[model samples]
Target: MSIEIKMPALSPTMEEGTLAKWLVKEGDTVKAGDLMAEIETDKATMEFEAVDEGVIAKIVVAEGTDGVKVGTVIAVLAGEGEDAGSVSAPKAESPKAEAPKAEAAPAPVAAPAPAPAAAPKADGDRIKASPLARRIAAEKGVDLSGVRGSGPNGRIVKADVADAKPGAAPAPKAAEAPAATAASAPAAAPALVWYDESIPHEVEKLSNIRKTIARRLTEAKQTIPHIYLTVDIQLDALLKLRGQLNKSLEARGVKLSVNDMLIKALAVALTQVPKCNVTFAGDQLVKYSRADISVAVSTPTGLITPIIRDAANIGLASISTQMKALADRAKEGKLQPHEYQGGTASISNMGMFGIKQFDAVINPPQAMILAVGAGEKRPYIVDDALGVATVMSATGSFDHRAVDGADGAELMKVFKALVESPMGLLA
Candidate 1:
């Protein structure tokens, strides 16, 4: 028997990926855990590993193929004692392929038999459900028994569990009938408007990463109610501290950037104002116990946020080292899913680019993002007298649904105090 090797889902949100490269070719012997291919997901390019030892019988999908869906067979492996040459690759059917004539009705008879074979088990055994479906049911407190299976062989799937109501009686078959009919009905296609080719322009296809970024940012702006709060903080104290820290750390080969200090300041502020470190769950507010800040990095493909896990607990030297590495890998598209996934809040600094002040879109599941601008000399009122001060404008974009205006203001106050004091971040 031959084992089919399918494209693996590298991230939870990954539905399709580019088959970037293949490390193994047909007739190549591979052991379990061996690297077989490089798959480029929306966030990063990850190495795919083999699970079973076998000889590569055939490569069904070639490298550089884009939009290869998850769970699609990419290759076939011949098991031990099986001849690699004898193993046949599955044929990829196209709409242009010739279809079977009416005389081939006998072939359809066997297909109907498999459908019945997948029917619900007898003897009142446990329901047949996908792992994802079971996990969703457990999380949603939905009873599996009450949920109807719409998958092949009457198996419960993720969609079925998602639509199932917890504690409520299963929908009557008559009620489900209309839904099934609606689902089966073909949706009308919208009219297509062709672009004018006479105009001089370039048509560049969007990469998977770019497309994902566009969709996610669009959703964030549309769904998350944004509340923007801006504060002007004196950066002289932070600058002096950074200079001294960098001098002392230079012996250790660690140079701290101003952004590193901002990261620490944001983390400390989150701890001081814990209420601001929260996310909006449908019916509940999820408050994080620790401050993990995602720092935005720009790559050739698009923007990515790589997290600094427990930024508050880590020292300035450690933050500098880790952030440098994370940013480097993020730009190279080598970051793992975990490195760029979850965070209590985020920091997107455009200070380096001389952006004075700008509001950033809130990354979903994260309630807030701090946008940092460049520090420049400005007239300040000190002791009721006008004076010069190096100040920077910091804007906090909070999800109005999760954080109150007072809490957001308090978070900003704490952040400004930490930066102005310059010693609390070290403490």
Candidate 2:
């Protein structure tokens, strides 16, 4: 029997991906661990590798195909003694595709299933599924037990859950409402939007990364009650410290950016004010002992936050080196899921762009995000006397549900002190 090669979930949350390119074509001989294709997920473009040695019989899914659901066969491999031309691809559909269709179904790009297939079957006592698939199932309210597995060894993948409908709910009481009220209910019509087409303009489709950014940002602003706090900090001490550190480490070839130091400062501040380092769940509050800082890096696709794990415990040199590597990979869309995933808090620096002050929206779950502004020479108080000094403005955006205004202010106070004192971050 020919072996089927399906689209793999490149990330924990990946449901569908674009087959950006294929490295191997039909008639090519491949061994385990050989690069087969490049898949573009919402966050990055990752290479898929072959797991079984065989002759490439056919490429089922063509390259440049976008929204290819996970577990959908993309290629076929003809084992030894099998005729390559005789090897046929498996029917490219999941069992849940047979479910009753709603009046309006979800968009194909969001969750595309193949042509009609068999009805979903139970997986007995154990339901096998990828982590990504399980998460997607929960979000869609789909029960995994009812979905049939299309993966190897009858494993459930993302495509299975994407095609499955949510489990049935208990019917409402007939006496609770008028029959006419229930029967006549209709969805509200969508509002019409107008654009000025008279002016010459070109429309471009949004990349997956851009689309995710739009959705997540909208959700963040809509769900999180944000409290903004601003403070002006003196940067003279930090600048001097950075110069000294750079001179000492010049032979090591490790140069630290101001953002690197700020990351350390923010981490240290979080540790000092533990109340601000938390994630707000609906029913509970999660407190983090270690400060994992997600530093915002802008890429060609969109903004991504590559994490510096345990920033409070690591040295400045390590932080600088790791951050540089992470930032470079982030721009190239080469960062892995773990590199950009969980963090206790975040920091975004717009200083390089000459932005003096702007409040940043909080990344969800995380209680707070520190926004750094440009440092400039300004009149300041020196030993109670007016003088000129390098000053910076920073704002902290906090989730009010998790962190109180006083706690947020305390974090800002500590961060300001660390930046002004400069030596506290080193400790």
Candidate 3:
């Protein structure tokens, strides 16, 4: 009995991945929790861990193959009593969910050819068809309801769908359009992008991370209505507080940065102005009670945001420690799915780079992102007199659909108040 191994979704956003490397090849035995392969997901390269024990019968998809859709078979594992040499890749991927399974249940052998008078074909009016069959049937306008399935238990496979046609096939077209648009349907796709080969240049395939960033940012800008608000914040007080706190915490080996303090400020502000702590779901708004701040960290592959959960409630020292660890792991492409996936809002600090000010794009689902710039000494008013104060520029990009101009302004007002006072963050 041979079980198929399929590509797994390492992250919620991963629809496909590049098979970076295979740790085990044909004839090697593996058990649950064993690392079987390195799969490059949208956010990171994660190891595919086996969930069962079996002999590697064959490698269905070779390493270095990118764009392998999640659930697509990548290997075959021979179970006990099965001849490893005889086990081969099946003609079609089992209609099972394509999650990476180091050990999947053995594929059902053809039920000893059904009797002359067998059970009814329909299973409660639900048609049983392999995913591939459903796809081809859709592309060719074949109707499964009328097509006799030739697979196990009278299930429809690709071969069964080949000749079936529907006079009113438009119905299948609507439901299966998404699957048909994959690379396999290249003939129907148009070449909308082309570059000059005449120019001296090198072309490289976009990594999974880069591809995801491109897609997400495009969607965020195109679909979300953006409103930008800028505020000049005095950072002198925050800087003084940070210096004082760092000295007190030096004994504990915890040092804090301006970004760390700002993370707390943003989280606190979200709670104060709960209206801005939201996500825009079509036709409804989701208001969050806790402030989970997603801090943007730049990695070699691309920018990834590892979240700081309950930033408003945690101490600055803890925030700093977690941020440092998360940033380190993110740069190494080692962050797990949960580490970078969800947040109530986001904050991006480019102050370290000395960028005076810039607007940041809002991470989808989250209503706003705060962009921080460098703090520099500038003349400012001190109690009715002109004096020098360290000032920084902060901009809030809001989703107008969910957060109104007034609400965003209130949130920024609270954030600035917290930073300017500094003591409020400690509380």
* Number of the top-ranking candidate, with TM-score as the measure: 2
Scored by CA lDDT, what does every candidate get? 0.82, 0.81, 0.81
- Per-residue CA lDDT of model 1 for 1-427, tens digit only, reads 8999998999998998888789999999999999999898887778899999999999876676666789878899999999999998765442113223322332444353332222222112436665556655655557677778775346576668776776642443673444323322221111122676579986454667887889999999999999999999999989999999999989999999999999999999999899999999999999999999999999988899999999999999999999999999888778999999999999999988989999999988899999999998999976689999999999999999999999999999999999999898898
lDDT of each residue in 1-427, candidate 2, tens digit only: 7999989998889999888889999999999999999888988777889999999998876676667789888899999889999987675345234233421232232232411111121111335565556656655557666688775446677667776787842333464223212321321111122556578886454668888889889999999999999999999999999999999999999998999999999999999999999999999999999999999999988999999999999999999999999999998778999999899999999999999999998988798999999999999999999999999999999999999999999999999999999898887
- The best-first sequence of candidates by lDDT reads 1, 2, 3
- In angstroms, the error of model 3 at 109 is 38
Weakest ten-residue segment in model 2 by summed lDDT: 115-124
Candidate 1 pairs with clashing backbones: 118-153
List the lowest-lDDT window of 10 residues for candidate 3.
Answer: 115-124
What candidate 3 gets wrong by more than 4 Å, as runs, is 1-3, 12-14, 27-29, 78-83, 92-194
